[model samples]
Target chain A: MSDFVQSLRLWFAPGRIKDEGETPDYRFSLANERTFLAWIRTALALVGGGFAVDQFLPDLRWGVRVGLALALLAAGVLCALRAVNHWVRCERAMRRGEDLPVSRFPAVLSLAVAVVALAMVVVVVFGWAGR
Target chain B: MTEVRDPGLQPERTRLAWRRTTLSCTVVAVLAVKVAVHDDITAAGLTGLALSALVWVAFLAVAHRRIRALDAARPHPLSYRGALLAAVCTIALAVCGAAMIW
Candidate 1:
C-alpha cells in the first residue's frame, strides 16, 4: 500500500524527530552528543566484531557462527537507531526542565553481552565447529 | 532574546567527540577492507570495502564541518544531520557484515 510505503520511508528518514521547545545549553547538547557518539562507537565495535568473527571463526559451527554474526550486526544497527532516540529524549527533557529519563539500556546491554559471551564459550569449549 | 550562555569549551569537547566518532568509523572501514580481502575478490566484498571507505570519508567531512561551525563567534546551531549520517553508515556496515558472514 502507498500508506505503508510512506511510513517505511519516514521510519528510515531522520526527520521524524523534531527538537521542540528552546535549545538547551550547549554543554547539555554536547554531552548528549558525546553520549550518542559513545554508543556509536559501541555500534562500530559490534559490527566490526561481527565481521571479524565471521572471517576468523571458521572453526565455529556454521549455524552458531552465522547466528552470532547476525546477532551482532543486528545489535549494532539497533544501537545506531537507539542512539538517536536517546539523544532526542535527553534534549526534550532538557528543554522542558524535567529530569532526564532513566535508561535501562545499560542493564539490558550487559545481560545481552553476557549471553553472547556464554554462547561463544559453548562454541569453543564443546568444539562445535568440527562437528 | 538569544539564550546567551557560556559554551565554556564545550564546543571543543563536542568537536573532539565527533573526531573520535570519525576515527572509529575509519577503524571499522579498515577492518571491513581486511575482511573483504580475506573473503576473496568477490563483488559483494569489494562493494563492502568501497562503501566502508565512502562512509569513513563522509564521516570525516561532516566532523570537519561541525568543527568549522563551532569556531564561529555566534551561537551556532547543532544539527542532527551528522548523527543521522553516522547512524545510517552503521546500518550499512551491518548489512555489509551480514553479507560477508552469509
Candidate 2:
C-alpha cells in the first residue's frame, strides 16, 4: 500500500520523470473527469428540482405529477449517460490523439425536460381554470 | 530499479470528484424526502434512500476503479459508471418528484 501511494504521488505530481506521450492524455483525462463531475452536479440539481416541485406544491393533479416525474427521471438518466459517454469518448480520443466527439444528448434531454415542464404548466392552467 | 510507467490517471481528483458527487446526490435525496413529508413522506424517503444507495455504489465503484487503474498503470482510460448511476438516480428522483405533485 505504501508503494501504491508513492507511485500515485509520482504520477500526479509535477516534475516527475515520465513518458512524453502520457502527459497530454493525463491532462485530458483530468479535464474529462471534471466535466463528468459537473454533469453529475447538474443531474443532482434536476432531481432536486423535481423534489422541490413536490415540496412547494402539494395540490397538483395526477397529470402534472406524472409529467414531472417522467421529466425529472428522463433528465437525470440522460445527463448521467451523457456524462459517462462523453468521458469515454474523450478518453478514446486522447488515447488515439484525436478530437473528442460532439455531445448531443444534453441538448436532446434539455428539450425533453422543457417539454415535460410545459406539460406541467398546461396541467396547472387547465386544472385551475376548471376549479 | 525499472522505472514505473505512469498510466497518467488522476486518481486523487477522480476520487474527490466521485465523493463530491455522491454527497451532492445524497443531499438532494434527503431534501426530496423532506419536501415530500406531508403528502407521502414514506415514498419520498424511500426514493431518496434508493438514490443515496445508488450514489454510494457508484462512489465505491469509481474508487475501486481509480485504485486499480492507478496501481496497474494500465492506461485503461475509460469511465462510464458514474454517468450510468446518475441516469438511474435521475429517473428515480423524477418519479418521486412527480409523486409529490400528485
Q: Could you tally the backbone clashes for each prediction?
A: 0, 3
How well is each residue in B1-102 modelled by candidate 2, as lDDT tens digits?
143544444555565666677677667766755755554547555665565556446655655565466444333433344345555555555555555545
lDDT of 1 by residue, B1-102 (tens): 353434477767777877788778887888788877784698887887787778777777877887887764343545767667778888887887687767
Score every model by TM-score.
Answer: 0.83, 0.60
Task: List, residue by residue over A34-107, the lDDT tens digit for candidate 1.
Answer: 89889998988888878777877887768988899899888888888878667666766777788986778878
lDDT of 2 by residue, A1-131 (tens): 67335434533442332332343545456667778778877877777766666556667765566557556755765676566556555655565566767756767877877887787788778878998
Candidate 2 local accuracy as lDDT? 0.60
Instruction: List interface RMSDs for the candidates, in order.
Output: 1.9, 5.1
Model 1 CA deviation exceeding 4 Å by range? A1-19, A128-131, B1-8, B72-77
lDDT score of residue A106 within candidate 2: 68
